[model samples]
Target: MHIIQFEGSSIIPISILTTIASSLVGWIQVKRYSELSASYILTAHEIGVIKEQASYVSSESDFSSFIRDAETAFSREHTQWIARRVANRKPK
Candidate 1:
């Protein structure tokens, strides 16, 4: 760790406070990362399920309908991602 400049002799409390703030920031980042990872995993799992359902369609019309629904779901997910990104940006 770098030596922090203390104007007077009150270095102990400042150093402890700095450490606590850094730890809190790190914890927040880890929580956000886990949440994002879960989101991606869930989206991928949904795609797999959609594919399985689409595979069971015996007619072209049914397959087309399934594809349309999958596209709509993907679009909605994209929109949600964009909204989240924007909201996060606004705070920062």
Candidate 2:
């Protein structure tokens, strides 16, 4: 007669748990980076639009308005990036 009992064998379970945790962390980092990149692209596009509009504006006030709008958009994008970075920070 032979009997086999599974005991004190946690390697497989631990390895799987580690893999899942790592994957989740990696996914979060990738998402955060993607969001940051998108924000940058949006800011760049806004700047381009502002430049185009400025070229056609015939008055100083109109040019100033476009510059103000571009600045606001940039500020908003920076804030969003900061928030995402804070949210994605690793727990201690």
Quick one: best TM-score, which candidate? Answer: 1
Put down candidate 2 lDDT per residue, 38-61, tens digits, no spaces. Answer: 878888898888778777787888
Evaluated against the true structure, the overall lDDT of model 1 is 0.82
| CA RMSD of each candidate after superposition | 3.7, 5.7
Model 2's number of clashes is 0
Model 1 lDDT, residue 65, Cα: 85
Stretches > 4 Å off in candidate 1: 1-12, 90-92
Give lDDT per model, in order. 0.82, 0.79
lDDT over C-alpha atoms for residue 8 of model 2 = 72
Candidate 2 accuracy as TM-score:
0.65
- For 46-78, candidate 1 gives per-residue lDDT tens digits of 898898897689999988989887997798779
Worst 10 residues of 1 by lDDT: 2-11
Query: How many clashes (backbone N, Cα, C below 3 Å) per candidate?
Result: 0, 0
